[model samples]
Target chain A: MRLAQLSERSGVSAATIKYYLREGLLPPGRQVNATTAEYDEEHLRRLRLVRAMIQVGRIPVATVREVLGHVDDDSLGRTIRVGAALWALPQVPEPDEDDAYVRAAHREADALLDTLGWENARQLTTISPAYRRLVVALAAFRRLGYDWDAELLVTRARLMHQAAVADLDFLETQPSEEEKVEAAVASAVLVEPMLQALHRLAQEEESARRYGFE
Target chain B: MRLAQLSERSGVSAATIKYYLREGLLPPGRQVNATTAEYDEEHLRRLRLVRAMIQVGRIPVATVREVLGHVDDDSLGRTIRVGAALWALPQVPEPDEDDAYVRAAHREADALLDTLGWENARQLTTISPAYRRLVVALAAFRRLGYDWDAELLVTRARLMHQAAVADLDFLETQPSEEEKVEAAVASAVLVEPMLQALHRLAQEEESARRYGFE
Candidate 1:
């Protein structure tokens, strides 16, 4: 196929595809002749993955390049190689160290990990956007005078971990490494808003029962 | 309390507080004199709620006012009024109707709710940001060539619903309507990124085990 077909098939514009090829986010297709290039199935597949990261995951192009590079690297184990893409995803700003609420929230986040017995996961905690987000949310709760109790936070996390396990099982069911990596990112970027939405719907259910609107 | 006192205690600058007052997001303080007005605890609480909606919830001021108005309306039952705020949150663009994939995804989303037995919650699904987000995500998966089996989507949604129930339980524990509404928005907006972060961390744990790194 050519650039025109790639754009038509992938739903990405020909010009944007050109930009990606120039930036090395997508490898160059085979040069058929002067002023013409041919793309293989691999190129088509790679184009889709790139679009997923940008469109669904909302990762920056620079970060997407790094993530794809990490995915392509063979030095690491297959799981770690693909998981590296996650480490490269954007992270949150560190909360102020001097703020007492932040300090307490940090301690609570650590303790919640301990309670969940996520020892190995904890090793990645310090580097994870998830951990920072939790700490930040906990602190924000306190700042707003709602002191999210430690017990409640832990309970919520346990449920989240269960969901994560289910997600991993589904990702493992994918047949290819490329698909697996795409699925992992897809699940992460896509399932997030879905979870939030389901939450609101569930809340509506709970609220109906509690207030007798059902 | 004076504006400075309110600022000092609330940690919002006086200028910002004045802006909130001028915007009618905050109720006017008691008029002690032409030079000074005294604010009560209610003003402080309302100010905090407004800030939560703006800074944490990222809701535009106009929308925030509408949400707060719904929250304050007495005719609606407690759960319905508070939950109304969620319906006002930002939603995703509706997927193209003529797209076969989108039409398929819409039916699947409907079935997902049916499978979960979320009968009452389904009423609010069309109006909810969560529903649109899920539909868009499901359609994207198809557009990208991932089938996202009906069983799998429903399974993922069940886990999400459980977590949501827990969230609603937590919200119910709050002591007042203002606090309840603020906590509802806080949980939705703040916990979202936290959930995404957790999913990534969980994937790490799963990858370690699957690849024999653990």
Candidate 2:
């Protein structure tokens, strides 16, 4: 198929496709002649993935490239690949003041995982700097007068863990290596919005139930 | 107290507080003399809230202003105030192609809520445009070859609804109208990062448990 058909089938404009090609987001199609190129099913698959990352996942092109690079590398383990995808996400900056509050939060995060018997919780910070930033952010919640201690964080983590288990169960069934990697990356990137939307919906329902807002 | 005291108490810099005053994110303090101004506890509280919205919540300054505007309006109902806060966050753009795929996802979102017996589920879109964008995003999941339908969505929503109930339980105790509004807005804005971080931590733990990677 030519670039035209790829654009038509993918619903991406030809010019944008060319832009992707130029940016190395999309691999160059096979040279058919001086002015034409052929794209195959692989290109179509890659195009869809790229579009999903940018358009749906809202990831920047550079981050998308980095994430895809990790996915394309077979030598990297699956865990590392997942970490890479997650690392590409925007993260909250850690508080500049390493105050007692920040240190307490870190301890609480570790202790929460310890109490839950989650053996790998402490290792999370080492995997991604975002995890440490997350801990700091959680501590900042206390400053807002919300008593979001380790107990509350763990309870919420446990619930979301169940959902993650369900999501990963589906990922385990993908037949191809490439499919599995793409699924993992998509799960990491896409599930955040899905869960957040669900969170807001739940908040609305809860608010109505509590406040009698019809 | 004055601007320096307000900064000292809130841990925000004088320059940033001045910027907030300039941006109208914080109200101007009362005039004390020709060159000095007096700020009270209200100023301190507003400064902290604005800092939380920008630094921790990662909300854009414009949206923060809009959300604070709604909060400042005493006549608005609690539901509307909550909606305003939800609206202020960054949202995913809805899929442009209103194809069968997009429509199917919408039906799936509705069906998921229906099956869950959640009465206020449809009201989510009315509350926040993010919900509609979320539905379209779920459709894009299928494009990535993940079989996420209404069933999976509801299951996740149910889990998060439980968490939301837990979060809102604390709001019941605030005695003053201002406290309630600030708590509601804080919950709506700050909880996303907290939940997202928990999600990531849970994912890491789950991945390690399944893959045996330390």
Candidate 3:
């Protein structure tokens, strides 16, 4: 298929396709002529994956390039490290806020993680910078009078990160690549609300169990 | 009494305070003279609240303004609507790559919520947008590939959200604001990890209990 056809098939614009090609994020298609380039099924597949990573994974272009490179290299060790690193970045705030808040949160999270004695903690180092930025910003709030010493908050963050690691570990154990990817995507999507909801429900159930005035 | 003094006391820069004032997000403090504005404790409280909405709750500036208006009105009914509206915005992705990826997973969570008959589910809405976003993103990925449908994902999300909600209700039954906030924060932080760990442990324990598998 030509560039136009590829764009139509893949739901990506021809401009973007060219940009990807220029950036070497996508390999050039077979040249039919000086004026034309022909693409194939692989290009379509690659485009979808790229979209997934950018639109769905929210990976930065630079990181996506590195990850795609790592995946292509097929180095199992590097793949694992890259994957773990990719998954370890802290969540971004909405906007117009300073980086300090996320830095503070990540710092608090790290301290909590340390307190929990989590092993192989270097897997999270990639996220430390962003987290530290948040923490610093949040420190301002603390100075302004919000409670920073809430042990429960610290414990909760530690536990949540620990749970994420465990879930990722389990997801990684899936034998099939397809299933692993599915589980990876699904786990990311499902875990937060699940956690939020579980806390709500569990507290209710536990409360009722413990203190219901029957 | 001046911008510098306010900045020092608030830990918010003069630039930001100026932005807030211009946007009407922050009310003008008492003007002491032609060159000086005197901010008081109320400005500090409002500023902290604004930071909380942005940093903690992840609300945007425009919505934050609306919410503050409602807060000032003290019309609980209108405030609830404002809260709900504010909750509907997407959780901004963190700068960290991993956090962004996790957030992207939430695309699927919307479908899962619908599949689980959880559309307009009140309790889930009350918690963090980050949680909700993650659930939906995961659902989107599942929809794109694999046999995993929204039904399964929704069930998990609902089960989790319900747990958290029940816990909230339980905490609310108590009299102390401290306990309530502690419970809310605890639920926010620990619920995900707890559920993830509990599920993993339960699966392992169940297998062992029933089939002699470790």
Per-model i-RMS: 2.5, 2.3, 9.8
Model 2 chain A is weakest, by summed lDDT over 10 consecutive residues, at: A142-151
Best by TM-score: 1
**Candidate 3 per-residue C-alpha lDDT over B1-214 given as tens digits, one digit per residue, 9 for 90 to 100:** 6778778877789999899999897889888888778887667766766666665556678877765564454333322332333343344443233454335444444444455554344334436454444545554344333334345444444445445454455556646543343334323332333344334323222222332411
Model 3: share of native contacts present?
0.12
Q: Write the residue-wise lDDT of candidate 2 on A34-151 in tens digits.
A: 9998899878878878888887767788888888787788777776777666676656565554687777777776777787777776766655655676677767876654564456
The clash number for model 1 is 2
Error of 1 at A127 (Å): 2.4
lDDT of 2 by residue, B34-135 (tens): 999999878877777787888777788998998888878877777667666666667766555567777777777777777767676576654466567667
Per-model lDDT: 0.75, 0.75, 0.51
TM-score of each: 0.90, 0.84, 0.57
lDDT of 2 at B165: 84
Over A100-135, each residue of candidate 3 has an lDDT whose tens digit, in order, gives 655555565466546655423424344433233334
Q: Relative to the unseen true structure, what is the C-alpha lDDT of residue A66 in candidate 1, on a scale of 0 to 100?
A: 89
By lDDT, the candidates rank as 1, 2, 3
Worst 10 residues of 1 chain A by lDDT: A205-214
